[model samples]
Target: MKNLCYTLLLLSSISSFAQNDSILNFQDETIYRINILLPGLEIEKDVYKDFSVVGNLGLFPGYYKNNNLFSNSEEGFFFIPFIDLQVRYYTNFNRRIEKGKTIVKNTGNFVALKFTNYFGTATDHRSTESVRIAGMAYDIQRTYWDHWHLNFESGLMANFRC
Candidate 1:
């Protein structure tokens, strides 16, 4: 009995020695930058001199920062990925005609799609765990001179814990 009691006491003391009674600030700080190149192509071209395809390449870059209430000891790093795509079409036509002059009007349409994924770890001084989130979104717009315009957008999101 005495040996068992002594063993238990020693184990308890060793565990306590691993912990310090110090106050700690828990927060996460992230400084990140990313860039993306998106290309859009019009399957068919009707307004250009030649009935060929029209396309445009777009480049965009941005920075992001986040400060979490928890620090590294109790916090984990994050990994995020995002993408966006856009397309536009433009056309011009004569609205009115006269013997010597003519009036013209402009019309255009646009579409966009976006997606994002966020995954990381969340920790409390002792152990770190993983967290993940995902989402997808899309948008469309159309316009015509002296006519009705239309716009549509939608999104879906999901969150996971492990």
Candidate 2:
């Protein structure tokens, strides 16, 4: 009886000592974001562990020269409405975690394929009113001040008919 009691006690102690803490893993989450440079609103839905679909809406300045059907030598800038969607894969979660960086809110290095459409006309640009752009880009995004998203991206884009 004493031998069995001692064994149980030792096993309990070992189990207690082994229960320390869980290992740190990657962070992925759905987030609502805003772009500072373009002043836009974005929604990112996490569909998988490292993949997300992001939708953005914004306005950009478009310069137009009055050369259309009902214009006469007038040039001005207008706010062009745009929308885009991106399928982003966060690629460097392990590397960022190993390097002791915060990976909260799906912030990390990513490669994304994007499609953007502009549907606003700067004058009477009926032929150019709607534009389709597709691109593949590599991006790195990091959080600052716990809530700021700072991102940099480089990519190749092509404008074509859709």
Candidate 3:
């Protein structure tokens, strides 16, 4: 009788732990941003319970035109790369339900710290110009569509160049 009771206790504990593991599992997402028909890729991975990291890569094609803002004619191509580390403290992690489904709660309000780097070169009618920019920003994302699980972000950024 004593051995049977111990076995049952162990089994119960294991089942409880398994259930909790499912509830706290990590989620991941991949996104693409469209820039005037050019596409950029971004990947986001959950790190901790309420934190995640995102990385992005984008490219812009070069063009030549007359009466350009920088000079009579300018042409250049460039790459933009950025990384963002953010935390989302979900206000309704497990409290919301829709159409008999438990609403995923990671898409909530968030604060983010971001770093961006830009390097490029442009050629004008008279001279060639090279530019490098490094920037940091603090951003906030607010949930706009709770049912559809969408959020928008706004931020201020500062840039430095060498």
Candidate 4:
């Protein structure tokens, strides 16, 4: 009876060791990833001279570059070509719009109006050209703690090309 009990104990120990050894010898594999997507953006300043704003106002004028397009080379190589442009903006504001709820309480509000224009061609061969005029006007009224809010907005949008 003693020999039988000892034999059972040894078998159980050997089985446990074998299970642990199998786990230790397991090899981890690496995953390979390929990305074929391309996106780009560029901004240039054409005019940045100081301009007077009767009320609280900020003015920015510059060039805009958008290269969000990818061009495929003849050799199956993918490349991104950048498009250049002139952009101008004029705006006036009553005050700085507060963003998000305030730490102290719910009281926060914001209003803004801006006009933007874009001029340039994105294609290297000048196959396409575009001119755009756009405007945005927004107003938001929020509670003292800013968790809830009401908003009113309207604007003009246009695009012209030749």
Candidate 5:
């Protein structure tokens, strides 16, 4: 009886160290997105306490409008390959936590500097030149029903042809 008591006491006294992360100030994860406007893979990694860097490789599908007198206006599916990167600063982590909101999956308001490179535009007549665009934007991200991610962003982008 004494030995069993001693063993139980020793086991109870042993320390177990683990991360309790009950309250999160920021998000750290790699997200695979295919059902959004930009379908691709992206990862958001922490660069500072509230700052993170994200990279994406995806396909851009849109319309091509031509305004030339010699040629007719043809509206066809234009699919282009692109790569994008962003430096994001999450601005509402503490506020969301205070409001009893779940901060899982990086859902919050953020300001980001975004950069993207287009390999080429796909159209009836293809262009061999590439384009680069850089911009800064305010973004809002949210998850609905735990799986659907909705995002909205608005900003000015400058394009450079190369």
Candidate 6:
């Protein structure tokens, strides 16, 4: 009786492990911008078990302000639009496993290559000014406790009139 119970338990555990592994297959995610009160969208798609690509687009509408310090009285409107593309490799995919099951997770340390572009125009209720910028950067992102995330990046950038 004891041997039978032990064998059944072992088999059940193995089946559960297999089920968990199957659930970790490639699943794409689309996220709307919430951290900032801006209109934006982000999409992430897994290309392989450990690699993914992400893209984001955002727009900022115009605002006006009075009682300017630099000028006597300043009132203006500005609009900006930006886009970002990134490639990420998840490091924990190869180093962590549980009960013989590998879990695919977005929370981990990742190295990313990114490109960004921005364009905007400002009007001070008088003259109009415009600008454009483009940049490429190497970035590192780390997620902790499945909730907190941080990112650091460095690269060369240039600005131009538009």
Clashes of each: 6, 0, 0, 11, 0, 0
Off by over 4 Å in 6: 1-19, 22-39, 60-71, 75-79, 98-105, 125-162
TM-scores for the candidates: 0.21, 0.72, 0.46, 0.23, 0.71, 0.52
Evaluate model 6: give its lDDT. Answer: 0.60
Best by TM-score: 2
Candidate 1, residue 13: Cα displacement in angstroms equals: 99
1-162: candidate 4 lDDT, tens digit per residue = 999999999999998754233222212322121212323332222133211111111122333344434763322222333332222232221121222222111112323334333333343432233344444443333332223323344545555443
List runs of model 1 lying over 4 Å from the truth.
Answer: 1-53, 72-91, 96-162
Pick by lDDT: 1 or 3, better one: 3
Q: Which ranking of candidates, highest TM-score first?
A: 2, 5, 6, 3, 4, 1
What local distance difference test score does each model get? 0.33, 0.80, 0.47, 0.32, 0.77, 0.60
> What would the per-residue lDDT of candidate 1 be over residues 33-137, giving only the tens digit for each residue?
122232221122334321122222222222334455685323334332323322323221221121222111112222222223232323332222333444544
Clashing pairs in 2: none
Residue range 30-115, candidate 6, lDDT tens digits? 32332255556666677876678888788766667578678887766665777778777766544444334334335445666666
Lowest summed lDDT over 10 consecutive residues: which window, candidate 2?
19-28
Model 2 TM-score on a 0 to 1 scale = 0.72
Candidate 4 wrong stretches, greater than 4 Å: 1-109, 125-127, 139-154, 158-162
- Can you write out model 5's per-residue Cα lDDT over 1-162, one digit (the tens) per residue? 999999987876673332225534554555565546776767667777678888888877766566788887665566678898999988998888777776777788999999999886534465545789999999999977767888899988999765
Ranked by lDDT, the better of candidates 1 and 6 is: 6
